[model samples]
Target: MSKNIDVLIIGAGAAGLICAITAAKRGRKTLIIDHANKAGKKILMSGGGRCNFTNYFIEYERYLSLNKHFFKSALARYTQWDFIALVEKHGIPYHEKTLGQLFCNNKSKDILNMLLNECKSLGVEILLNTKVNKIRKNEIEKGFNTKTAIGDIKCQSLVIATGALSIPSMGATGFGYEVARQFNLKVTETKAGLVPFIMPKKWLHHFGDLAGTSVNSQVSCNKHQFKESILITHKGLSGPAILQASSYWSTGDYIEIDLLPEKNAENWLKQMKIDKGDTLLSNILSLVLTKKFASKIVSLWFHNKPMKQLSEEDIQYIAEKLKCWKVWPEKTEGYKTAEVTVGGVDTHAISSKTMEVKSVPGLFFIGEVLDVTGHLGGFNFQWAWASGFVCGEVA
Candidate 1:
């Protein structure tokens, strides 16, 4: 048998659910299909289960895109306030985390429940465990037909909200990119974002033992800088600061980290030389950071030299090391632990205002499937909400 709908949304994710609900509410016959048995699997695991749904301070600057300004239209059309209003309407209690990021007061389930409840209220049809086997465009009707395990489904407007390949264990795949390619849409190269870094073998050999030891530091790569906690690991490094910097860091690019971010290393070292002149460099580092981390760093750099016996040049070198410790990571942990994918369908071929394909009308793309990616702290979720809402309005 064949099913027909006004709009068929692929992938019952955060974006797909939102788009489906919005379209159905507008009296459009909307159907959402997903291979996964359940919806919002990613949402259930986000923010450690609390789900950071959106940010209070949403700006275009937080997003990273090749065009850099392609997200402005949809984001402006459906702002963070609009999502906040939806949350309020659902009566989901939420609180603002640091830096204007918002999280559910209860659990991630609250956000998913809100979305699912809205979908039900709008009478949107949702099919779970529905695997799509093939997709072909109906040239006569200028529509797309999707052959699924269940049956064939046709729609005037088809939205690909399958998202990017990030958390594969949660059923992530490149089906969206594949579908785009089938339609001759240009897809940019993809990489992992918001992932951990893997230091060189030499650095790992020395610092691997300091796994789980974390400290606050300022991390910089490219033009991006973030002040957050960095945790050393057996593999290399992972933490908020490292993850934030990883988005901007590419292979072969060196990352600069200020270990003692708040202190002037030169001045502090000089003061320590006067106050505890006989103290060993390892002892001084131990006082500032954890003993294990200090010992490893000092042993590697200063050879555990006594502060009183060290020459001025040696002290200066130590100061420079503390002030600007450049970490030339061997590579990132890749998509295995990445929170989001960094690239997708090119923006040049799509309408920024409607998220519709410029060359292929009746086709739309939304959410993380597009090249538009946001930084950490709920920015991506806001993008999901904004893009889905706007696409639904126009789909």
Candidate 2:
């Protein structure tokens, strides 16, 4: 006999777990399942294993969506404070690392365990390593029927919490988007978000040796800008600034970087010329940037000569390049290394209030699977908590 469920949620990640817990607490028979052997793999691996759970600042402005205002209602309803309270209630020791990002003081497991504990306490059934082979509308029951690896089940409400394509090792998949298509819900074009930029071979040939060096600067692309440390990698540039700009970048786009964000480069260079005209330009740059990086910058962008040798025009040119250095990245590192997917199920087809499909009565999509994506530093996790919480109340 087919099992009957009031709610059946796919992908027992952050959203699925919370949604199941809420539904079960509401006296709804809930079952949450995932194809992965373990639930909350992403949560366990986030923030270098400590898990940046949420941010102090969570506004709709931090996110990117086709429907910019769609995320406002849910986020306001289940604010970051609510999630913070949940964390504190579980006695998970955490600290603010930087920019109001809250990370577990111990390990990411603390966060996962908290969510799992909530599920257990609410009597929500969880199944790991279970796959859904197919799903179809159940007209007789006025619900949906799902064929799983173990057995068939019917549910009045179905939630697609399967996250978007990001860390494949974490079991991220396009299954959520496929399900949206199956339901005839419009899905937006998706891309890698908060990802690293891959430099062209010709550019890497000279700068690859400075792979571990980092520069604090402001990176801008497509009118979006972020001030963060930019790390030089063997493959290309990968750092908070580059990753933030990657979300707004596209193929063949040029990224403008302010290498010396704090100093007035022109005035600094001009003063240095009068003060120490005998020093080499590379040597002068070493006062601010790493000696090796300064040398590389001089070699790549300007002629490395004594300060006295550089004319006024040369100083102006060098200053302009220092503050407004431009380079075209070949492309992003793609989904495998990306922190989040840029888009998924279009929010226009989803109800911002309930996270339910506008046309499909019992279908819902939440978390990263939706087109909504947040900036780096824990906003994505907040989105998961908020969207999941709101969807849970109804689904």
Candidate 3:
């Protein structure tokens, strides 16, 4: 019931699969194990099944980590262009969606199949539906004995690519964090990232009426601003802009949203008063924003007044409100609805260049298990590829 491998990768997710491919290609005896029935469950469902595999524009600042610069080395060594080339090599057609986010032309399964094919070509072993019960590192022999439901696995190097607690229904768990703690590694405060915000009851009542309505907006939080469409949800605010800002948001913090990012509201209002004095303020707003939202704004702020009735002060006030509408979020939707986990095993204790535990040789952590969380888009997947590739080179 005991098997030995040169490299043992836990969790046959994005990182583990890539790591196995890399190691096996290098002639190492690699085996990737996962408890899931099949590999790449997340990848199959990501980006509405298209899978945003990597971003066209990648930078070090796009990732959040305790050590901001830790990802630079791996990312640089395994660039997005490299992955893109591989995808092209496989003849899996892909296209850029927006803001440099690339997605498969068909389905996420294409990306998964590409990785699987590469691993197969290299003779990598993938054991699915196998749960690891215990992992004990042998200090004297510099190896690991991992007990699983299938059997006992012994390996010279162990790679923990088990992702953090993001989507519990997808079988996501804190197994990676538990493994890190078993080895006496430091883990930072964890929270949901790339999640939608739930507004206060009063605010929800007013905005919930506009649920399903989308508006072009510029949302800012924690000094980060995103210009995209914000959707009004029954629970609260969502859409790309709101979701991007949510990564930087905490409870009690207010988010500033520019409803009219493309226009000078004050100047436009003054001109409207001169040209169409008979028009209602709500009518003017309806031209740019949704009629329901405009009517609500007029009822709440202007008392449904006509354009001619507003004084210079009122004009200025309305303009300022449109430019900087602030709203406080009660809380996030939590990990159940989050795209990724914000914090994880502290990067300071790991070698950024090798993705190896500095104090514990042959032990490695990669992908979402690390504290590094990428911004919305394909950045997270890119991190998985880069970190896994780097670790496979040495591990």
Q: CA lDDT of each candidate?
A: 0.89, 0.92, 0.93
lDDT of 2 by residue, 32-143 (tens): 9899999999999999999999999886778999998999999999888999999999999999998888999999999999999999988888998999999998877688
Q: Weakest 10 consecutive residues, lDDT, candidate 1? A: 302-311
Query: What stretches of model 3 exceed 4 Å from their correct place?
Result: none
Ranking by TM-score: 3, 2, 1
Cα lDDT tens digits, model 3, 55-147, are 999988899988989999999999999999999999999999999999999999999999999998899999989999999998877889999
* Deviation of model 1 at 200, angstroms: 3.1
- Cα deviation in Å at residue 34, candidate 1? 0.4
Error of 2 at 288 (Å): 1.5
Could you say which candidate leads in TM-score? 3
Poorest 10 consecutive residues by lDDT, candidate 2 = 16-25
The local lDDT score (0 to 100) that residue 359 gets in candidate 2 is: 88
Candidate 3, lDDT over the whole model: 0.93
